[model samples]
Target: MVRTRLINHPLVVGLLEIAAGEIGYEHRGMIRVLCDVEQFRQTIDLVVEGD
Candidate 1:
């Protein structure tokens, strides 16, 4: 959600938690996506549901 530099890269899929909902995966080779941290934080409460 946020434009963050991943502090950790070796995160396993199981270990890395993702919010429940649909994501627009525009590219397959896109390893990461960037968004405003503030915007993400604001919408997080409404977006984040169960894992």
Candidate 2:
């Protein structure tokens, strides 16, 4: 999934660490992003923009 790809990036990993306690994996390699939706979106946006 998108998160799996994002997780490969150091920048995204650092940003995700802010909410690491809340983030987890679900069944079949799916990730559960339980942090602020806006913040998560921004993280993805930052990584995508960087690419």
Candidate 3:
């Protein structure tokens, strides 16, 4: 996926729409868990560095 300052770009909007539709709801939970794990890892790294 590409990020653009132009939120209304037709091609990017279309591509995101198609991608969103293709990702099933069943996989959302897994994605959320992965994101949570990433956040946790970052938090741990920050704590370690503070020592």
Candidate 4:
């Protein structure tokens, strides 16, 4: 904590911020990025299974 505070450089800060946000999502108060990896789906089968 003390070491990082001493190095108040923009580049370092930006990287550190990203790393922190990635791990500390709930506490940091930031928007989340949700993504869909696989587009293909068995829609009929999924619906039947759910029912």
TM-score, predicted candidate 1 vs. hidden true structure: 0.27
Model 4 TM-score, all chains together: 0.34
Scored against the true structure, residue 50 in model 3 reaches a CA lDDT of 50
| Model with the higher TM-score, candidate 1 or 2 | 2
Which lDDT values do the candidates have, in the order given? 0.35, 0.66, 0.44, 0.40
lDDT of 2 at 37: 73
Report the lDDT tens digits of candidate 2 across residue range 1-51: 364666878867665565465553333453455567787788788889988
Measured against the true structure, the TM-scores of the candidates, in listed sequence, are: 0.27, 0.55, 0.35, 0.34
Worst 10 residues of 1 by lDDT: 12-21
Q: What digit string (tens of lDDT, one per residue) describes model 4 on residues 1-51?
A: 113333354534454476566666455564322223231123223433454
Residues 1-51, candidate 3: write the lDDT tens digits: 212343345533443455466774455433222234455455445544554
Query: Ten consecutive residues with minimal summed lDDT in candidate 4?
Result: 32-41
Number of the predicted model whose lDDT against the real structure is largest: 2
What is the model-wide C-alpha lDDT for candidate 1? 0.35
Least well predicted 10-residue stretch by lDDT in candidate 2: 22-31
Off by over 4 Å in 2: 1-3, 15-29
Q: Over the stretch 11-41, how does candidate 1's per-residue lDDT look in tens digits?
A: 3221233321124344355443244556445
Per-residue error for 51 in candidate 1, Å, reads 13
